[model samples]
Target chain A: MNNRQILSAAIGSLLALGLVSNASAAGKKMDMEQCYGVAKTGHNDCSSNKSAHSCAGQATKDRDAEDFVAVPKGTCAKIAGGTLKSA
Target chain B: MEKPANDSLPCIAGIGLRAPHYCEVLEKLPKLGWVEVHNENFFGGGASLRTLLKVREHYPVSLHGVGMGLASTAPLDQAHLSALCRLCDAVQPAAVSEHLCWNSVPDMTINGPMVINDLVINDLLPFPYTQEALSHVARRVDQVQEKIGRRLLVENLSSYLSFTSSEMSEGEFLSELSRHTGCAILFDVNNLYVNARNLGVDAKAFIKALPAEAVAEYHLAGHSIRDGCLVDTHSTQVCAEVWELYEFALQHIGPRPTLIEWDSDIPVLAVLTGEAEKAQQRLEEYHACFK
Candidate 1:
């Protein structure tokens, strides 16, 4: 094959691989709000001072307990590792 | 007027009344011969205790304990015993029962399903039925009986493994303990069925060997299949095989205060009442044969 054609094919393969990896990674990301919704309804919220409707406070406390690291704004970098990041 | 003889429990069939259905059962006042509840669940005076008190007004309640650690080498938990005594005073349960197994150890090595070193697994733990173990269990039973100011029924546990060092059979240990402590037996038919299938223990021999007169109650529950063995998950409906075993037990041991126990994935009150009705039918049939 010609050198130009070979270079074009190599670029195409890398782009395809990147897209596949991104798609796989995207599948792992969970919607935190949806998870909170399920937990609020599914389990008995035994948090002493908070009602079930105020689950946002419990979620914040849980996130704080895990020392969760938030993703930087305006950056498409990979999220930090932890259950909260996945959520 | 004198209170009726408590010995009449042998002719009744009851259901394990859990928290979820307490209000409905008490409000509707279902025709339950008796009701049993886990003693641990009502240790503290709260909504659960209040509900149980209301139910006690209408039915005879049996306090079945799940966390006594009767055979544990560790010192008996005073708090647990005190809680039980308090409950006994409040509810005046017709009978109280704990399992014939250990869930704790001395050197902080807890033995049970969910263990964290010295901490108990919050589940019953089976042990080898050696003479020493029997003596330990008997002593514990004696203490529980003394504290409660009444006889305590010890239930046979459904075990997954058999220890190579077991010096005697579970039935022998239980019979011997009863002889020594005068404690009653709560003969759980489902546990025997599970052990018979999983550990090659003979269910018929177990039923036959138990001292009939000492049997104060019977427990029937459903189990789930796991890894080719049956675990007493108590989540679903009682299987036909277990029900048949209950009938066999009723015939062998005679009708006793049988309980339909469903702990997890509990259904509506009607479902449990339906199961209790089945047991009541079997008990009535047994009574018919005797007559």
Candidate 2:
């Protein structure tokens, strides 16, 4: 098959398998907000500002200083001590 | 509305935009001169690229790369290069930069065809600063600039140890590399400070040796000291000593686009902005000296 034909078949297979469509659909509706002060120790999304750990899952305290979790907007405030802005 | 693309980096203070602050920065649109992000993070089309594009709409973006491995003996990673090219096309970044270090090497061949698989160290590894290495790095820089169609800014590395085999200083090697490839320099003051503390590098002499005209930008980051060795962890505020060295650099190299980079233990958006504001104050102070 020609290069164009090969490319078309590969993309067609991805579409038929719902991989491309699923990713496209997911990308369109991103509403996740960073909910701060709620993540358990060693359970944060990425890095922390007040802690020595730089990578994910390295927080040393339960009430992390600057670590966060991604939750839907307006729900973070409902959790006790959770704020949109970092403490 | 999509903001017009800006190809020139403003000589002002900015923060390194990490993943945690993306949502907040996008939502609030804080006043900033510019912002930089690791180019490798947004190589694919998804939420990450989408958010970066949205950031491009507000502030000029600079693409800082960590995985280019410019001095690697192995052939340049074409796939990584192509991805970076596509990212530049999409973002129209004000600047593009990579570290002056090696990451991978070719497969080892022992006596009588005993071959070992190639290894990628996956970290910024330093090499001896010699004429041979200089020529090799210069050739690689030429290839990268040709592929990207722009001058690549090479940042000096923060090494923990010095090589006895090195024939020249890191600053001299960088100067020769810029002279050979016509590339620019991204002088990281914090990296220099770390080298000074850890390896007893002469920070002042290194700064004086650099080709001031080739310096296109400056980087300021915080580091941590462990067991008498300073590590460029970028997890805290820029220390007083690094700031002093930065002022020395400003006096020598002149004011340039400076960035406050906090990678590990990423801080709150306000803290990052506060750090950027401190850098802005220093830049203005230096600029007022001439005016």
CA lDDT for candidate 2: 0.82
Clashes in each model (backbone N, CA, C under 3 Å)?
A: 0, 1
Provide the overall lDDT of each model, using Cα atoms, as 2-decimal numbers.
0.75, 0.82
Q: Model 1 has how many clashing residue pairs?
A: 0
True contacts kept of each: 0.00, 0.02
True contacts kept of 1: 0.00
Model 2 regions lying over 4 Å from their true place:
A1-87, B1-7, B109-115, B288-291
Instruction: Please give the range of 10 consecutive residues that has the lowest summed lDDT in model 1 chain B.
Output: B1-10
Residue-level lDDT of model 2, residues B1-291, one tens digit each, is 111223389989998987677767777899998999887777777556766788899999999988889999989999999999999999999999999999888887779698766567777778999999999999999999889888889999888888899999999999999888888899999989989998888999999888988898899998887667787878889999999999999988899999998887777899999999999999998773221
Question: How far in Å is the alpha carbon of B120 misplaced in model 2?
Answer: 1.0
Tens-place lDDT digits, model 1, residues B1-291: 121334334457788776466556755898888888778767776445666777788888888887888998788999989999999899988888888987787555345555454566566889999998888887888888878877888888888899999999999999999899988888988888889989999888888888988887888888877767888877677788888888777778787778888776669988998888888888888774231
